[model samples]
Target: MTVRTTARWALLGALALVVTACGGTSGSGGAAAASERQVQVSATFAQGGGGPAYTYDTALVPAGATVEVTSAAADGGTTTTLRVSGLQPNRTYGAHAHTKPCTPAAGADAGPHYQFRPDPVSPSVDPAFANPQNEIWLDVTTDASGAGEATSTVPWTFPPDRRAASVVLHEKATATHAGHAGTAGARPACVTVGF
Candidate 1:
């Protein structure tokens, strides 16, 4: 592996350790509840086939790339953090929480963005339903080293009846225009994250 790749893995490992360390249950009032509100996952992109984390476009996402997701619900809201490495350098990737797990066939398998309030119409372009406040948007811009991170905090938590199951990375940054709000380009990669 290249030096950059090695360093990225090391960083991911450290982040995993930090998340684990902070996830311990205290067995006291509200302490265990607090720990239960957090979720963290780290996975390497599957190369030859589909897996928990898969790269649909090898040219952009590449094999062996790593994705780390951290979601925490507290203070009457939910905050999600997404970190990615070993992707194409100097590019912005649009990512959002999806309604289903990823599959080998197509990015569509991951389903639509997990909206706190379901949009009445399909392909929701209306800002009222597609805005960041209604859905988790994590658009990350990679640097020269092909590493990037993004965080999104929404005012509401994922309801028990419906929760996000994956994170889909798109080809470009998300569009916020009136007619194209929440529209990102083709999906290049996906990571199945339980949140």
Candidate 2:
């Protein structure tokens, strides 16, 4: 081949190589971006209060988003799933996420509900005055071994300014709301939710 023709061909090859290296595609197609972050939590309850021993595992949907405690187990026990939605920020929600396989003690269920606190005051009591942000209420059930599952869609915003905290299960059952501290019962197991 002539020198000039050879040079032109080599340049064309080099240009093609560059284009391929730059991820030139045949059509307008690209990988999809990842969605919001998801957080998963796993908790195990030992033989506390001389009661049952069990393990619980659950997946929390978007980071800082509302979660519906979907499924759970107590020594392989199961229960009816509960739906608790729209969690509030700067407040504590009461939840009983586990309901079954059967702990050692008869009443040794997942104990009481969880209390996310510092919420607003109850409107029913003080008609005009507004209460502080308090806790989320959940509808949950358990099985024979005191194991169950609960889910909620949290409406609360996870504060960016403060440090991350956790949800704790108490040794005793809690009130519908976390009415009294130290009285909600002893903290059995705790699991951190956000980063």
**What are the RMSDs of all candidates, in order?**
16.1, 13.3
Residue 10 displacement in candidate 2 (angstroms): 22
RMSD of 2: 13.3
Steric clashes per prediction = 0, 44
Residue 150 accuracy (lDDT) in model 2:
50
Candidate 2, position 54, lDDT: 25
Q: C-alpha displacement of 184 in model 1, angstroms?
A: 0.7
Best TM-score goes to which candidate? Answer: 1
